[model samples]
Target: MIRVVVADDQALIRTGFITILDSQDDLEVVGEAGDGKSAVEVAQRLRPDVIVMDVRMPVMDGIEATRRLAGAGVPDPLKVLVVTTFNLDEYVYEALRAGAAGFLLKDASPQQLIAGVRTVARGESLLAPEVTRRLIGRYAARLRPADPAVTAESALTPRELEVLRLIAAGQSNAEIAATLVIGAETVKTYVSRILTKLNLRDRVQAVVYAYRTGLVSPND
Candidate 1:
């Protein structure tokens, strides 16, 4: 079972989430907190696999709580998925920077909420929202491009680069194979190589790096 702890300033919201999550056979609501301070404490005590975090808590807030939890090195650190009603928030990006697994709108469908938990619990990030992906592209434009000099010219062969570009365009491996007229397994191989060379955690990070490195432009 995936252990979950909900942290939100609203008592009703916490109760609502706990009820929703506990309904799932595969998930258990181990604890709940009305503030970030108690959140950190309960999470450390229960060692939940996932934390349904809310951004605007009474103290510390979600971003700081995530940073502190990660930095303090909780023995079995929880994967925080920020749940908020607002789609656009100043704190969202900072929360991600502080190592939140992902963010979800509070009104997300039950399937999406459950999927968010499973994705983070499995050590994978949820797919980047299209708006958030574009946000990252704009964020990348602020920095000078990475050294533009790569040692291994053949590290990602021309074909592999094509595959990487498709991934940056948000194409799944199966989708890329269909578009490129290649086998899915071959596409997966190319993806693995791209990640190995780039040292990214997952495809979402790869897409970010692709834009940052100019491998794929914002228009592309």
Candidate 2:
């Protein structure tokens, strides 16, 4: 089963999420928290597979909590899926930068929410194409380039670099294969190699890395 912890300041929303998630045979709501601090504590103690986190909370916010659990230097980082009713660009970008595996609007369908949990549990991100482009575009415009020493550009072959750019552009494996006129399995191999070379945890980080390196611009 996929263990989940729901963290939201609002009781109704929190309970509602629990109901929807627990109804699934493959999912279980193991814990709930009304604030970010407790959320972190519950997560650390329970070690749930995925956390469904809300942005605004008492004491600490979801962004900081996510950073604590999944940020750059942390070992054995937990997977976080940030959910909010607000469409604020800064919130989305900050949550991603803080190492959230995915982002979802609270207004998302129940199916979408459940699918998102499964996706994150399987080590995949859930960035909506349009929202991802806009948020990453803003991030690229505001933040400085990532450190030169950490860049793995030279580690990738030209084909791998092209695949990375397409990934940063939000293309899926099948789409990339179709675009490149290659087999889907070959595309998957390239993706795996790219992640290995870049040392990215997942495609979400790959997107951020691409933007941070200025390898793919917002307009691209």
Highest lDDT among the candidates is held by which one? Answer: 2
TM-scores, each model vs. reference? 0.75, 0.94
Poorest stretch of ten by lDDT in candidate 1: 145-154
Model 1 CA deviation exceeding 4 Å by range: 70-77, 85-90, 128-134, 138-155, 211-219
Q: What would the C-alpha RMSD of candidate 1 be, to one decimal place? A: 3.7
Question: Total backbone clashes of model 2?
Answer: 0
Model 2 spans with C-alpha error above 4 angstroms = 148-152
Q: Where does candidate 2 clash, by residue pair?
A: none
lDDT (tens digit, per residue) of candidate 2 on 89-134: 5787778889999889889999999999999999988877766766
Model 1, 63-122: lDDT tens digits are 888876653354545678887654445566556656677678777887888888888878
Strongest candidate by TM-score? 2
Superposition TM-score, candidate 1 onto the true structure: 0.75
